[model samples]
Target: MVSRMFRIETGDDKDRRDLLRRRLLETNTAASPVLRALRGTPAERQRPLHLWVMDEADELAGGLVGHTWTTWLHVTYLWVDGRHRGTGLGSRLLAEAERAATERGCDAARLETWDFQAPDFYRGHGYRETGRTEGIPGGHQDVHFHKVLAG
Candidate 1:
């Protein structure tokens, strides 16, 4: 039997990261017919979707930040200032983002919120709990939610 020798190193390197990402994309595209078909299509790329609410003084109140890719809107963050919570601003922002995503041909939306966060708010907005990860920070659960957008 023959043995091989190689070095396994890890660090934050931009050029290496880019090369690795390109290689992985190529491999995935080659392995999956769906991904191969998406190459060079608009739906293949993730586009940012953000909505912001401002107060009368032009300060930030609440916002939603996420991206749309392949018929889905992934909401990464949604936050409202403590003074603005429970004022419906968050709902409005979320609604607007969903509208824009639907216009972009998305049929579904998803987001993750901690147990201490707005799981109930999402439920009230017609989202359903699809899964959960326990033992998150503060010993809480990370809840995942999904909603079928009104397209």
Candidate 2:
């Protein structure tokens, strides 16, 4: 046996984080044939898909921010102002985002919403609950949803 010494460190280090991500990507590509095939291809890159709705006064009414990669759309954020709620702005924003994602070659969409958020709203838009994490945010739950996009 050989003796060795190592020190542990942790913080918000961007360079190290990037290095770790690159290494993990390389390892996963080497381990998976599907990932290997995606390397260096256009589909390997995530494309941003953002949609915004503005009022006549130039104020933001609603918006959806997400990205598409490898035939899937990952919705990071979707929001509508209180005044715009129930006016169908949220639904319209989501529909436009899905349409754009479909145009980008995405076949599915996924997102997470807190229980206090619009889980039913997403379900109403044809998204189905795929996962749930309870006890989040003190007595609330985080719901994950997925939807198969129509061509």
Which candidate tops lDDT?
1
Give the range where candidate 2 is weakest over 10 consecutive residues by summed lDDT: 37-46
- What TM-score number comes out for model 2? 0.81
74-111: candidate 2 lDDT, tens digit per residue: 99999999998999899898989999989977899999
**lDDT by residue for model 1 (1-151), tens:** 7879889998899998867866775777778787667636442456889888889989999899999976789999999999998898888989999999999888999999999999999999999999999999779999999999998
Q: After superposition, which runs of candidate 2 have C-alpha atoms over 4 Å from their true positions?
A: 1-22, 39-44
Residue pairs in clash, model 1: none
72 in model 2: Cα distance from truth in Å?
0.8
lDDT (C-alpha, whole model) for all candidates: 0.88, 0.87
Native-to-model Cα distance after best TM-score fit, residue 47 in candidate 1, in Å:
0.8
